[model samples]
Target: MGAAAAAAGADPPPSEAAATPAREDQQHYVAAATGGVSGESCDAAAPPAGGGGADDAVEPVVIDASAVAGGAGEEEQGECGFCLFMKGGGCKDEFVAWEKCVEEAEAAGPSVDVVELCQDATAALRKCMDAHAAYYEPILRAERAMAADLESFQTEEAASHSAASALASEEGQR
Candidate 1:
């Protein structure tokens, strides 16, 4: 299903669960990147893990605020203003409506068409956020700038490494 469908809580078609036979306890992490939601850019190279030269690294924006906040027990927030609405920041009532719809759909079982059922709630939430674009636009712009800087830095680093490797090879041949 598409983003709009998923956002609307549409039930997924046929599960590969029977074919793949996933463990019941296995967890899944789904990261959705919707255009104009968080920022304008697509996913970029992740920052190098562990300690690196602070000056050379571009810190990643914390996208999942719930993770940083300690978990579901804590306040859920997101990196962007549009997402903040789901955490009781803005458009909260609309978000709650969507949340409720999804919960109800899920309780109805896998056969139910959650997306079809929740479209109204999803649309309501979407409308609310659209109305508040003035607050989120600048934040999203900043995020896009940061993502661009990160991509540039990664490109430069790759070039630098290639040049250094060439120099090392030349010296070894001498």
Candidate 2:
């Protein structure tokens, strides 16, 4: 018998061949044989299912250093009277006056009286500067500690808000 006749079982119709597993295999083979690109990295195409890009995962923190510094300095000054004075009115005026006095004394070419007056003024200004710093150091430290505490509280509050928002979103999805 011929090969096609034997396979058809004594005059079976040709359409019956398509019902066999071999036909299914051939269909799958033909479907897979179509021309297309292969073996390319998936990252160049769409991301995997349910997986987001890097930026969608975590955001960055942007710190304003100058603004932070200004806030800390203001807090320190508010806590320290000497710091406030130095920032407000005292240091510049005193330094300018001292410079003028020194200039006048030195222009006289170092006479005993001029030298003595200049030395006394210099010592007095140095002592005042030292005393000012000594008086304000504790207050500035206290203000810095308070600012740190406030910053921590704010960070915690923000984190709590983010977590709460995430929980709400998950519940909504359900």
Candidate 3:
């Protein structure tokens, strides 16, 4: 069988056997194949005589970073003042003002004035975040509880999908 069929884990039809290998420009391959190449690796031709078909092979289970416990997901963000300031971001006018301040200070190079400017910016940003936490712990706890439930659902959903992969999709339904 040709390299394409070998890569595809099947033999080509005998009628197509006389065709020449496609030129580099003419060759077609799946763009999303492993390592971004669709061609078969040197050792990945037909299986040994008695070996089972490629369809019998099980795909390796890969753990995604999003599945990591306590991972920083989009919904899980700043519980603290400084973090909220940075993550939530400010309005355009506020951003422009802060950007201007920092840019001017940076343009001045190393100096006591620049250091003071940075300190002031930090204080302002922190204050902005502290303002949002006005209601304190009770609100925070409710938010955390909701987040925990969401994380639980996501983890369970992913685990179910991974486990179900072992069975044929139709078999599972039956």
Best by TM-score: 1
Give the least accurate 10-residue stretch of model 1, judged by summed lDDT. 21-30
Residue 43 CA displacement from its true place in model 3, Å: 47
Arrange candidates, best TM-score first: 1, 2, 3
TM-score, every prediction: 0.33, 0.27, 0.23
Tens digit of per-residue lDDT, candidate 1, span 15-121: 22212212220111112222334331112111111211223222112234434245554333233323332332245577657766776887798998877888787
User: Local distance difference test, per candidate?
Assistant: 0.44, 0.37, 0.35
* lDDT of model 3, residue 96: 33
Candidate 2 regions exceeding 4 Å error are: 1-131
Model 3 lDDT tens row, 51-148: 11223222222212232223444212212211222222232233334445665776687673754665555445434423433212222333456668
Top-scoring candidate (lDDT): 1
